[model samples]
Target: MLTPEFSITQDDDFIFICIKIAAIRFSAANLEMLVDENLFIFHLSPYYLRLRFTQHLVDDERSNAEFKSQDETIRIRIPKATKGEFFDDLDLPTKLLARKGDILGADAVKAPSKSNAGPLIQEIDTPGENGNLEQAGEDFNWEISQTPMPPSDATRLLTSKYGFDDNYSSVIGVSIANGNDINELDDPEKSNAEDRVQERLRKENLKFDPEYYVSEYMTAKYGNEDDIQINGIKSLLKFTPPLVKKFLKWYKQADDKEAVMSVEFTEVEQQQMQKNLPKKTYLVDDVKKLYITMLSLLFAYMYEQVENEGVHNTESAWTIGKLAPQLSFLDQQVITESAASELSVIKAIVLTGIRRSLSYPLHRNFDLSIKVWNYVYYTLRGGKRLVIQALLDLHEVFRFHDVYYVYNTVLISDLCAWFIIAGNENIIRSLAIELKKELDQVTKKDIDFDCVCGIDESSGEVSWENMNIEEMEILSEQEYLQQSGRPA
Candidate 1:
C-alpha cells in the first residue's frame, strides 16, 4: 500500500498557504490512468482560493478490500497563495486527487469487490420470499391477537396513561395531558360529586357548568339573539345538564316579566302627545324613568277601565294632562291622611312598576304614556306637603340631585300650575317663593344664560336692537357705570 502525504505552509505577508502532495503512483500496465506526474497548482487570494474540491472518489485496494489488490499514489501541490485563495488556485485534477486521497486515508480501505456501491441487495429474508423464513420464524413465539378491549377498559387505559380518574372522560383525559385537571373535565356529577370534587374543581379553576361559559362567550361575542341553540353532543357533555336546566328556567322567568308590560302604543297618539308637550329635555335615566312610569300607569288605567268601567276605549289613550289629575287624587287619598305608613309601600310599588316598564322589551302608546305622566304629576302635586315631608323623613334616599330635581320640578310644577289655574294665587305665590329660594341656591354659581335668553347674533337678526324699557334701563346703567370711572 502506498501511503499518501501532504505538506502545507503559509506565507504571512501574502496571506496564502502553499500545499503540496507527493509520491502519487499508478500501475500504467494494469490500471487505466487519466493523467500522470501532473503538477496541479492553485492561485489563492485573501478572499478566495483558486482551486476548490467540490466532490471526490478514491479507488484504493486497502480502502476497498473486495476489489483487486493494487498499489496507487496521488500527489497535489499549491504554491504562493493566500489562505483564502490557496485552494482556488489549484487545478481540478489536483483538487480531486487531494480530496480523494484524504478521504481514503480517513476511512478503513476495503476490497472493491465487497463495496456496497453496486446493485440493490436485500439483507433480510421474509417468510413469503424464502421457505427458510418459516424455520427462522419458529424461533420466535407468536400467538393469536388478544380480543379487543371493552370501551370501559380502553377508557381506563387512556385515563391511567393521561393521569385521569373515572370522573374524567376521554376528552377531559386529553385536556388533563394539556395541563387541565380531571375535575375540570366536564362531568355529569359536578353537583352530586363528593365535596372533594368541588374543592378540586375550584383549585383547577374549572366552571361547574360549562354551558355557562359558552353562554357568556356567546353573549360577549355575538350579542343577544332571539333564540340560541348549542350544537354537538360531545361538546354538550362538557356541561352539567341540570345546571343548564336551572339557567333556562331563570331565563324563562325573566322573559315572562319582560312580556307582561311590553305593550305598543299608537303612532297617532304619540304624535298628539308630542304636539301637546314641549320637546323633552331630560337625562337618559330621567327619560327612562318617565317612560316607565307612564307605561305602568297606562297599564293600571287600562286595567281599571276594562275591569271596573267595562269600557274598551283604546282611543282614549292616556295623556300627561289626563293621568296627572288621577294621580293627584290618588296621592291625596293615600298620602295626606293618617294612612301615611302606606305611602312608602305605594311609592315602592310605583317605583318598581316604573323600573319594570323601562326594562320591558316593547313600547307603549303615547296616549297611555301621557296619562301615566299626568297621574304621577298630579299624585305628587296633590300630596305636595305630604311628599315633601316624606322626602324630609327619608332625606338620605332623596340625596341624589337628579332624583331631587325631577321630583321637585315636574311634580311640584304640576301642583303649582293646577293651583294657579284654580285661582288660588296665595298657594301659588307661597309655592313660587319657596321654589325661587331653592332656585337661587341652585343658581348661585355663574351660569350660561345665553340659551335661556334666545340671543342668536350669528343669525344676523338682532331682536334685542329694539330694546324694551327694562333692557334700555340696564344698558343706560351699564354706560353710566363705564363712564363713572369707579371700576364698575
Candidate 2:
C-alpha cells in the first residue's frame, strides 16, 4: 500500500504543505490535523504524516485548511513561527506511523514494529459466535454469550457512559444544569437587587410588558456558543411529539394571558396600534418560562453563529437586542457566504420553531413568536432603508413554512400590519401585495369549498358561497371591533 506523501514549502510568513491523496478514497472526515507548539500531526485515517519545526509555532486556530480532492492533494496554509525558514527541510527529528492502523479508536501512537503487513481492517467481537458464525462449531465460547451482567452493575455502567451525576442539589429542586444563578436563586439577601424576575407563572394577571420581557431575554445570556444546548433545541425541532405538546400547553397559557391582557388594555383604551398588537408575560413566566429559558439559553449560540463571522465590538452585527427592531447589518448576499451560514441556520431554526409554535389550535403562540420577530423589526426600526430587507426576510421565513393559512388568515391582520404602522408602510405594503399574489395561487388549490357550503351536517347551519370567509378571518381585531360597533 502506498501511503500518501506530502511536500512542504515555506515563505516569509506562511508554511504551505501539500499531499498527493487518492481522490477516490479520501474524504473530509477521513482526515485529522492536530498542531502542537512546533509539531504538526496529519492523520488521514490509516495514513500518518508528521512534521516537526525547530521554531515554536502559534496555534492553528487561525490557520486555514484547504482540500482539493480534484487536485488530489490538501494544502494547509499554516503561519510560520519565525520570520525565516519554518523547518530545516520538512525532515524533522522524528517521523512516526501508527502500529495499529485503526483510525477511530487509535489514540495511542507507537512506532510500527518493522511490519511487512500494512493497512487497517479492524473490529471487536463482543458476544460469542452462535450458529450463524463459521467459527461457532469449535472455536466459539457459548458460555460467554450466556453470561449476564448484574442489574445494578449494568445500570451503573449505563449511567456512567451517559455522564449522569445526580447530586444532593437536585434533591432540593436545585439543578446543576439549571443555567440560572443558583447563588441568586438560593439566597434572597443576595437577590434583593432584583426580585428574581418573578419567573413563577400563573394563570391570572399575565405580565406582558415588552420592555421587561426584552430585558429578561437579554439577561438570560447563554454562552456565545454551546455544543450541548443547541443540540437539545435541534432535537426538539425534529417533530418531537412530546415537545410539541409541551410547547402548545405553554403557548395556550401565553395566549390566554394575551387574550385577558388585551381585554384589560381594551378597557383602559390604549391609543397606539402597537399597544393593541398582542403583549404578554415574558415567555419565562410559567410553562413559557421553561420554553423561554431554553430560548434564552440558545440566544448566545445564535449570537455566536453571527459572531463566528469574526465581528469586532466596533463592526455592526446583529444581536438579540436588535433583532426585534432591525434587520441584520450583514446583507442577504453576505449571509449566503460561509462565515454567515451559521446566521442562516439560526434563522431557519428560529423560523421553524416560531411557525410550529404558532399554527396550532388550543394554543396562542403568536405573542412568543412576535417577541422573536421584534428583533428584526427593531433592526428595521433603527433604519428605514432596512424596511425592504425586513419585509423580504419576513416573506422568506413565512414562505419557508408555506403555511398560507397562517400568513393570509392570521399574519396580514395583526403582525405585518403592526410593522407597517410602526414605521414604513410602503415596504411592508409591497410585501403584502407580493404575498397576496402567492396567496392567490395557493388559495386556488387549497380552497376548502365544502366549508363554504357548511358541510358539517351535525351543526345544521346554512352557508353562502358568496361569503367573504378569508377576508373576515383575516380582518384585524380592531377592524372586526369597528365593524361590530365595539370600542377600539
Candidate 3:
C-alpha cells in the first residue's frame, strides 16, 4: 500500500518512459481457503494511466472518476527533466532556489530519487552580452575616479588615507611653524629703516633758524616799522616843553659862562643853558644819525627781501608802495634840484647815487633796490611817455634824470620789458617806437654837425677844413711840450 502523501514512480526500459503511481489497488486476503492468499488487481488501460497522471500532476488533482476521462483531459504532464530545466533557466528567486537545491544538491548527494533527473541546465536571457557587463563595470570605476574631491577634508584625508607625510606637514605643521616668523616676513626691514628715517627727519626739522623765520613772516605780513622811525623827520623835530627845558639845561653846561650871565642872552639861550648839554646834543645827533642809518638799513632790508625771497609782480608793487614814502624822504634830502633845466640831469645823478649807495654792503638790506632802479631807468630811456611823466612830475627834475640813469645802467633790458608789459604797455610801446626812430635817424645820418661848424671859417674863427700854419705850429708845440712833461 502507498501512503497518500508519498509518490511512487516506475520506469519501463522498453518505452524509455518514467511514470508516477499515485495508489496501487490489491485484493484482500483469500476468498477460499487455500494454501496462500493471492492478490488480484485489474489492468489499467493506457488512456486511464495517462488520465491518472494528468489528474495527479497536471490538473493538480487525484480522482478515480477524472482518471477515467482521458479524452476530456486539457492538461499535459510535463517531464521532470523539462520542468527542472525550466525552473533552472529562470532568474527569479524560486528558479534560483530550485537550481541550487535540486541540481547542485543532486550532484553532491548522488541521488536518483526522480527518474530522468539529468544535470539541471539553464539558458539565461540578458539585455547585453558578458562583454557589455565588463564595460559597465569599467565605466562605473572611471566615473568614481573622475569625481571631484571635497575641499574641506581633502588635506586631512590625503595624508591619513594615502600615507603622504608632506601633505600632513603642510596642513598642520606649517601653521605652527609660521607663527614664529610671520611678523618678520610681513615687513622685514621696517623697524630698522623707520628708526633711521625718523632720526634724519628730526634733525632736519630742527635745522631751521626759528627767530629769523618768524621775523620774516611778520615783516612780510605786517610790513616794516624801522623805516617809519628812521624817516620820521617831523616827529623828531617837534619841540615839546620838556625837550625845550632839557635843551636849556644842555646849553648851560656848554661852558658859555658869559652867555649864561649876560642879560642880553635871549630866553632861548637861557633855556638852552638850563638843559643837560651832553645828553641833549647826544640825543639830537643820535636821533638824526639813527634815523638816517635806519632808513638806509630798511631800504636795504626790503631790497634783499624782494630779490632773495622771490617777490615779483604784484608783491613787488606792494613792497614798492610800502617803501615809497621813506624812499621819497631820503631822495628829497639827497637830491638838490632848484631849476627845471637841471631837473633831468640832477635826477639822473641822484638816481645813480642811490643805486650806487644801495649796492654797497652797508645798504644791501634794501630789497629789490637794484631791480627797481633798473626798471625805472630802461623804461624811461625807451622814451615811454608814461615813464617820462612818472619820473619828471610834469617838469623834468634832477630826480627824474637820476632815476633814468640808474635804471638804464642797472636793469637788464629784457627784464625791464617784461615788467613794463604787465602795467605800462602804452608807454613802453611808444617809447620803444620813438627810440627806434631816433636810433634809425642817428645811424643813417653821415654829416657831422660839429665838423660843419668848424668848416665855417670867418670873423676870426679857426677853420677845421684848412688849419692856418700858425695854429698848426702852436698845436704841435703844445702836444710835444705836454707829452715831454708826462709823469713817466
Candidate 4:
C-alpha cells in the first residue's frame, strides 16, 4: 500500500491529521481508521498510512473524522488521552514516524528458539514445475558481464572528510612534514606593516558598538514619531520576497552545467591564498558540525554584502574580519595538531552568523532581524554548490570596485577550507538528515549572542552630554528608549 501525503498539527487537546489523496473520491464507508493507543492506522483502498506517536490518542465522542470533497482531503481529529497535555516534537514529522522498537529501545519482533522452530520446505523435487529437473541443480549466471560504473560527483566528494583532494594538495596541504621552522619567515619591514594593520584593526573593533550603530540608524530614520517611515526599510535591512526570488534565480543560473564552473583565481592570487591556508592539520570529531560552521561564516559574509548594497570595500571587509573573531569563539579554541571535537566550532560559527547578520544589523527591531535571519538560514538550504556560486558571483560584484584583500584572504580562506573539505557533499541535505531532522530547528529563539560573544549591550550606551544641543532636542533619551524598547 502506498503512503499518502499527510500533515499533523496539534494545540492542547486534539491532534489534527490532514491527509491529501489527490484525484480520488472517497466516502465515509470507503475510509477506515484505527487508533490503538499511540499507533494510528488510516486505510483508504490503495492508500495506507501508519503513524506512531509518543502521546496516547483516543477516538472518543470529541474525536471526529471528515472527508472534504472540495480539497480532496481527509481530516482526522483525535483527542489526546490526557487533555491539555502539550505534545513535544510535533514539528519534527520524522520523529513522529518512529517505529515501536525505536521508541522502546528494543526489537519489536522476537525470533523463536531453534528448538521450537520447524522448516516448512520439504524437498527440492517440488521446484521442477516445468518438468526440467536438470536446470534446478545447474548454476545460474546472475552476474552479467558489464563495465564498472564510474563514481558519481556526490560519491567522489565523500572521499575525504576535509575535502583535501589531489587537485588542491599544493594549495591546501603542506609541502613538507613538520616544516614550520623550515618555512620562510617574513621580512622585518613586512612584519612591522602587518603589526600596524593588526593594531589599527583592533582599534576599529574596540570602537564599534552594535547598539550605537542601530540607535544612530534608527534616530536618523525614525527620530520624529510624526514622520515615522518603514516603506523602503525592508529593501535595505530585511530579505524581502523580491530579494529572495532574485537570489534564487542567480543561484539556479550559476548552478547550471553550461555556466562557468570555477572561481577562476589568478596564479598570483592562488599563491597568496596557498600561503594563507592553515599550515597545520586540525582534527574535527564531528565532520557535519564543521561543515555547518563553515556555512555560517559564508552566510554571514553574504549577509554583509547584502547590507552594503552589493558593494565590497576595504572598510566593510575589515569590520567583518575583526567582528568574526569577536562574534565566534574560534579565537578561543586551542589550535593544536591534535584533533578536537567540532561542537565548539559549530557553536562559534552559528553565533558569529547570528551576531553579524541578525544581532548587530538591526539594533532597534529585534523581531525584524529575527525575521530576516530566518530567510538567510532557509536560503542556505540550496546546498554548498549554490553558496560557492553565489560567493563567486559576489566576488565579481566586488571586483568592479576597489576590492579588499581582507575579504578574500581572511574570510574567503576559511570558507574555502570548509568548502573544499566537504565540497562534494550536499551540506544542507546532510544537515537535515544527519545533523538536524528539520532545518527550522535553528530558530529565532536561538539568538543568544551577547552571552556567547561576550558583548555587554549596555556598555556602549550613547552619552547625553556628548550630544549637541540641537541633536539632543531632536531625539530625547526617553523617546529613544521607548522606540528601541530598551530599559533606561
Candidate 5:
C-alpha cells in the first residue's frame, strides 16, 4: 500500500490529521481508522498509514472524520486523552511513522555533567607542562581533542586491496595522503579548479522561486522553526531507540569516559563496513569522536542537499563525492596528524553544523539561517564545548547497539543511505531530535553586544581588512600601487 501525503496539526484539546490520497472520492469504501493507545492505524484499500505518537488519542463523542470530495482529502479529528495535554513532534511526520519497538531498559542512564568550571578547550600535552591548560571561562570547557593516528600496516594492506587508498583525491583534485600538507589543498570552494568558472556561474545565476520557497521549503503548516526544534527535542526524550537507552545506562556506570570514546571496532565490524563504506585507511586519533564529527557533518549535509536539490537520487550521490572536500576538509594525502579539537576543524564543523541544523527540514531562508548563526556565535561563546557536548550525547546514543562498530555499521551507513536512498528519510527525523536539542539549548543565552564584527580595533571603526578582493571597486592609489607592486 502507498503512504499518502499527510499533514498534522494540534490545538490544546484536539489533534488534527489530514491525509491526501489522489484516488479517494465520495463513493470510496473500506475507509477505516483504529486508534489503539498512542498508535493510530488507517487503511483505505490502496492507502495505508500507521503512526506511533507520543501521546494518547481517543475516538469518542467529540471525535469526527470528514471526507471532502472537492479536494479528495480525509480529515480526522481526535480528542486528546487528557485535556490541555500537548503533543510533541507533530511537525516531524516521518518520525511519527516509526514502527512499534522495545522500550529502553534500565541500563540507559544520564550522561556526564558538562557544568564543570574551567577552560573550555584542551590540546595534546606538551613537554614540561602538566596536562592542564587554562582559558577564560567560569568552569565550562570545550570538547576534548585527539590527534588522528597513522594507519597500521594491516589497515594499509586492506585499503590497497580494496583500491581505495588514494582517499578520493581525484574527485576533489587534491592529495592529503600520509605525510602531505593540508595547506597545499587550497580553499574547499576551489577544489576543482578546472570547473571553477562554471561552478561560480551556476551559483551566481540560480533563481529563487517564491512560491516553492514558501510552500515547500518553509513548511508553513508546521508552524515556525523554533516550534519544530523544541518539538524535535521533546521527541528525542520520549522516542529514542532501546539500544540508545541501554548505552546511556552503561555509560553512566563506566569508570573511564575517555576510554569509551576511544574504543576501536572489531575485525568483523571492519569487514561489514568494507562492503559499503569507503575502504581507505582512516587517520583517526579517537575513533568514536571522529565518527561523531562525521555524523554531525553528514547529517547537516544531507538536510541541505534534500532542501536545495529536492530529494535523494543519482545526482545526490555525485554531489556528495564532488563536495566531499568542503564537507570534511581532508584530502587524499596526509603528512601531519590532525586532531578533532583543532580550532580549524572545530570551526568548520560549527559553521556547517549551525547553518544546516537551524535552517533545514523546514525553513530554508538564507537570511534567517545567518541570523541564527550570529545569535549562536555570540551567545554561548563556547561553540567548541557546545558541539562536543552534543557529540558526546550522540555518542552514547550510538553505543547502545554497535559499541564495537557504531561508526562503520551504524552512524555513517544510516546517514549515507538516507542521503542517497529514497525510503530511508525516516532516520533524518531522529537525527534532527539530537541536533535540535543542542541548537535550542545554546541559543537561549542573552546576546553578547561586545562580540566582534570585523571592526578595526585600533581605529574603533568598521574596517575592510578582509573585504572581498573581487568586489573591491574603489581603492586608494597607495593600495592599488601596493597591489601592482606584487608579482602575479
Candidate 6:
C-alpha cells in the first residue's frame, strides 16, 4: 500500500496538481496518465500509480499533463468544472480543507495536518484499470488507503461558504454577466459618494491651497453671501477661529513647542486676528505656510463631527490632508501590519468610522493609514516629505489627549504608503515581517495599539487598547524639527 506524494493548488479557473517522483526515463510506453472527472492516475514504467480528486475538473477534457525536465516533477493542470468552483464531490480529504498549515510531499510526511481525519489512504494500482495508454493501456485496479470523512463539512465549506456562488472576484464598479453592477447593486450610497467625489475632484481643478480653494468651492456654493463676501475681502478662513483654539491648545500640550510658530500669517490672518495672534506677532508671524497644515487638523475635527448637519466629508479632504503628518505611531504600526486581503474591508470600515471609534468584533476597517497617506501626498504641499514628522507630532498630541481609538483610525494604510514615499523601504520591509510575525499568533484586531513594538495590552473599558500617557514613546517635537529639515 504505497501512496505517492502530491500537492494541490487552485485558482479561479484551474486546479494544479504536482506529483513528485524519482527520475523516470522518458518513453511513450513507460510514462502515461488517465485524467477525467472523477480521478487522476499517473503511471511510470511497470509500477502503476493513481490518485482520486476531491473535485472533478470541469474541463478535464482540456486537462494538460507535462513532465518538467528539471526536479523530476509531474505536473497536471486541470481547469475547475465551473469558472470559479471545483466539483463539490471531487474527493479531497479534510487535511486539505483547513486553511492553516502546509501540505507536504509523498514521502509519508503526511501533508501537514492540524488533526487526523480517520486513517491514511494507501491505494495500489494494477495496470490498465485506469487506461494507462497502450491503445488504452491494460487492465488496472486501484485501491483506496484512507477513506475521508463523509462529504458534509468539506462540501458545506466548498459549496456553501468557500465561494461556490460568491462573487468575490467580481469587479466593484463594472457590470458582470447578469448585468449586475456592484457599484449599483451592493452599496449605492457609497458608490454615488465615490462617483460624486471623483467627479468633483476632476471638475474643480482643486488645489490644496486653502486661500485659493474658494474660487473652487465656497463662492461656488454660496454666491455673494455675507460670510463669503467678508472672507473674500479679508481672506479669513471659514473655520479658523475654532481650529485655532484647538491648535493653540494642542500646541501647549504637544511636545512640539515651536510648531505653532510655523504659522506664517498672510494678509488674511493679519487682518482677521491682528490683536491676539497678529501677523509677525512677538512670538511668530505671517501664518501663511501652516494654514494648510492647521486646516488639515481642523478637518480631522470636522471629520469627527461630519455626521452633524450641513457637514460634508469631501469639504474636509484637502484640509484633513495637511494634518496627515500628525498621524500616530500606533496608527502607523496597525496600518503597516494589516492584512492585504483585509484592505477593502478596512477601507469600508474606516470610511464608516470617520474619526470615531469602532465597536467590538471589529470587522477589519483599517483603511485610515492608506487613505491618510494617499490624500496627504496627493493634496498637501510637500506632504510626502513632511508627513513622517507630522505623524510623530500627532502621536505626542493625541496620546496626551488620550484618544486611543481616534489615534488608531488615523494611522491606516495611507501611513504605510507614507513610509514608501519617504523611501523607507528597508524599514517598511522590517515592519511587514514584524507584522507577519505578530499575525502568526494573534490576528490584527482593533485593540490596545502601541508605538515601539508588539501589540499593546488591552486597557480596561476602551476601544482597541489604551495605554497611559507615560507609557507612550512621544518624540519631542523640538528635537525632530531641529533635525527634520522643517522650516523655522
User: Which candidate leads the pack in lDDT?
Assistant: 4
Q: Assess the local accuracy of residue 265 in candidate 3 as a C-alpha lDDT between 0 and 100.
A: 27
| Candidate 3 residue-wise lDDT, 304-368, digit = tens | 23342422232332233223222211221222222223433223222333333222322221122
Indicate the residue-level lDDT of 242 in model 5.
26
The global C-alpha lDDT for each of the candidates, from Candidate 1 onward, is 0.26, 0.31, 0.25, 0.44, 0.39, 0.31
**Among these predicted structures, which one has the highest TM-score?**
5
lDDT (Cα, tens digit) per residue for candidate 4, span 264-342? 3333333332333332222333344334434554455555555565565644443343334321222222111122333
Model 1's alpha-carbon lDDT is 0.26
- Every model's Cα RMSD, please? 44.2, 26.9, 63.5, 25.0, 19.4, 30.4
What are the per-model numbers of colliding residue pairs?
Answer: 52, 18, 36, 2, 22, 47
lDDT tens readout by residue for model 6, 1-488: 23344556677888777766664565655767766774566676633445444456554467787877788777888776667764431222222221211112112112223242211101111111111111110111111012223555554333221000111222222222433211112322122212332332222122122223223233433346775564342232222322333343544465533121232223332222212110110111111112222323433443332212224233222223222322210111112122323532223223222222211111112232223222222212222223333333333333233223233232322222222122221222222222222222332232222222234357443233233222221223334346767753
Cα displacement (angstroms), candidate 2, residue 459, comes to 27
**Which residues of candidate 6, in runs, are more than 4 Å off?**
46-49, 59-61, 86-488
Question: Compared with the true structure, what per-residue lDDT tens digits does model 1 show for residues 234-302?
Answer: 222232222123323443455332111111223332222222222221112112122223323333433
Pull out the clashing pairs in model 4.
Answer: 162-421, 163-421
lDDT of 5 by residue, 340-436 (tens): 3343333334334433233223444333433333322221222222222223323223234322122323234443322221121112222222233
Over 4 Å off, model 2 = 1-352, 355-488
Worst 10 residues of 5 by lDDT: 124-133
User: Which stretches in model 4 have alpha-carbon errors above 4 Å?
Assistant: 1-232, 238-243, 246-290, 311-316, 326-348, 357-365, 394-422, 432-488
**What would the per-residue lDDT of candidate 2 be over residues 1-488, giving only the tens digit for each residue?**
33455666677777777766764577787778877776677778666666555455666565877878678788887887666754542421111221122111212223223232121101111112221112211221111111223556644342211000111012212221343221113422222111222211110012122223222232222223464254233222222222123333443455332111111112112222122222211111122111122222222222322323322231112222122111111011112223232433223224323322222111212333333333322222122223322332333332333222122122222232322222222222222222222222332122111223345588976663432223323334445458769785
lDDT of 3 at 104: 29
Worst 10 residues of 3 by lDDT: 276-285
